[model samples]
Target chain A: MREAYHDQLGELAEQLASMCGMVGDAMELATKALLDTDLAVAERVISDDAKIDDARARTEEDAYSLLALQAPVATDLRTVLSVIHAAESIERMGDLALHVAKAARRRHPQPVLPEAVRGYFAEMGRIAVDLARKAEQVIRTQDIDLARVLDDEDDAMDDLHRHLFSVIMAKDWEHGVPAAVDITLLGRFYERFGDHAVSVAKRTVFVVTGKMPGYSSDATDL
Target chain B: MREAYHDQLGELAEQLASMCGMVGDAMELATKALLDTDLAVAERVISDDAKIDDARARTEEDAYSLLALQAPVATDLRTVLSVIHAAESIERMGDLALHVAKAARRRHPQPVLPEAVRGYFAEMGRIAVDLARKAEQVIRTQDIDLARVLDDEDDAMDDLHRHLFSVIMAKDWEHGVPAAVDITLLGRFYERFGDHAVSVAKRTVFVVTGKMPGYSSDATDL
Candidate 1:
């Protein structure tokens, strides 16, 4: 019974790591769809979000079962609770990717991003995928060092987000208001993707270190 | 000891409901700050967000302690877990309000909304406050009917969000790209505020029914 309980806990971590991978793939494909205006890929990302949500539901149920059946205390209990928190954060990462894909689909056949601003989005997407991958690694390994790396990547994403804003607000912006609005929201989606990754990392840190890193303010701040 | 555990559970509900109230006050003041361009009010909202975060930390700590020390099973365990979930949703609502307040501060001395679209924001703010208040009531009462009302209120928020978009995207929109961008983000903040409120209500419903309401999709969709 003891060993099985530990196995259930390990399975929860595996489920969470899988979710991170799913969201990473979603963001990567959604970015490609946005840049290439591929309606098919965008649609795929939108449809795949359901799978992530299902995974979250399954993980939460498992965590609840573990708590009720095993009555884990101390670090074991914290681990179960953290799994629930991290699952929600990862599910939200999937939703952010869905938003990116929906943006791509909404302006199908016409690129959501302007020519000059495409590079910023490409970099942002790359960082977002990287953050998601690292988040997966952090969850799988409970590596505090890797989790800390998400913070730096999130900073890079934030810088790219600000740069994207500057470009949209520039006097010579010729794409006009509609495109600007799309870019503003798209940029926000990518930035928030990074934030949720950091949030997942923070939850992992809490489980491992027994102390929350930077608990005063979350990464979702505007 | 069981009585003490039940008391702790009741305290958790009270803490979460108070958090809902704090965020409700924050949104009301934030909307006032945004509409009036009141820097002081905006600044107050910004600073007060720390209090909400602090409340979350305390609530989570208490909940964690209860789980660790009490080792509650079945309904008791689910109640503790739901409190954790609702605290997160309420804290996020507070963050959304903080985002609104910051937007107001960023455009201080100049109104964030143009005169033409001020009515939309005023209504959005009113609805956001209303949602938060109802969320508080739902947490306190755990009334499924009241929880379901949040869904209709969320629908109202979505319609306003769409109408706000149409206004901004209108050909006669004279505010230009920058204002459009601000309004886009500000509009999104309020919409998400409503979404989180609905999320809180859903968690309460889950606690009452032992099943997640609308578990397939969340209210955060674009």
Candidate 2:
């Protein structure tokens, strides 16, 4: 019985790592849909977000059952609790991906991003996908060093977010108000995706080190 | 010992309710700062966000201790878990309010919103604060009926968000791209604030009903 209970706890971590992969795929496809104007791919991303939500629900239920039935204590208790926190952060990453895909769908054939600003988003998308992948590896390995690396990547994402704003506010910006609005929101979605990815890494660190990082919140305004 | 354990659980609920109030006040002050262009008020909101973050950390620590030392099971376990989840949602609410204050600060003295769309934001701010206040009441009372009312309030917020977009996208909109970008992000911050508030209510309902609502995710793209 004890062996099975421990297995369940390990399985919850595996589930969260898998969730990271799911959202990474969603973000990759969503970025493609945005840049390529592929409505079908965008639609697929939008619909598939449900699966991520379901994954979170299942992980939470498993963790809750572990807490209730197994009555895990000490390190085991922290593991169960961290699963719940990590699951919420990963689920939010999926939602950010969904927002990206929906942005692609909103403008359809016209292209959501103007040509001048498209490269910024492409780079942002690359960094976002890489962050999600790294977060998955961090969850699976519990490597604090790798988890800390996510913080640097998040810095890169913030730089890109700030650069995008400079482009919008530049005198050469000819996309007008609507396109600028789209770009602003798209930039925010990617920035927040990075934040949540860092947050997932932070939660993993908490489970391993038994101490939360000094900064609890990951939010910042552009 | 059992009675003390129950009191700790009750205190967790009270802590969450107080968190709701903290964020509610933050949102109110943020709105005031944005509308009035009061840098001092925006500065206060920005600084006070630390208090909300501290509240979340304390609540989570308390909940974690309950899970570790007391090893709460069944309803008590659920209550503890829900405290973790609800605290996260409330913290995000505080972050959203912080975003609003930051937006106001970023464009200090110049006002983030132009004369044309200020009314829309004014209304959005009002609804966001009301939703936060109602969410606090729901957390305290565990009143599912009051919780359901949050959904209606969220719908109202969505309407205001959409209306703000319409005004920004109107043909006569002369606020230019920078202002449009600011309005877009500000609108999104309030919309997300409403989503998190409703999420808090849903978690309260889950603690009472032993079931999560059908709609697991509250995110949607404009």
lDDT of 1 by residue, A98-161 (tens): 9999989988888888899999999999999999999999988889998887898788888888
lDDT of model 2 at residue A163?
A: 88
| lDDT leader | 1
The lDDT of each candidate is 0.90, 0.89
Interface RMSD measured for model 1: 1.7
Q: Give the range of the ten consecutive residues with the poorest summed lDDT in model 1 chain A.
A: A213-222
Per-residue lDDT of B122-178 in model 1, one digit per residue for the tens?
999999999999999998998999988888988888889988888988889998898
Every model's DockQ: 0.68, 0.75
True contacts reproduced, candidate 1: 0.68
Model 1: residue A215 alpha-carbon error in angstroms: 7.7
The TM-score obtained for chain B by all candidates, in the order given, is 0.96, 0.96
Which stretches in model 1 have alpha-carbon errors above 4 Å? A215-222, B215-221
Best by DockQ: 2
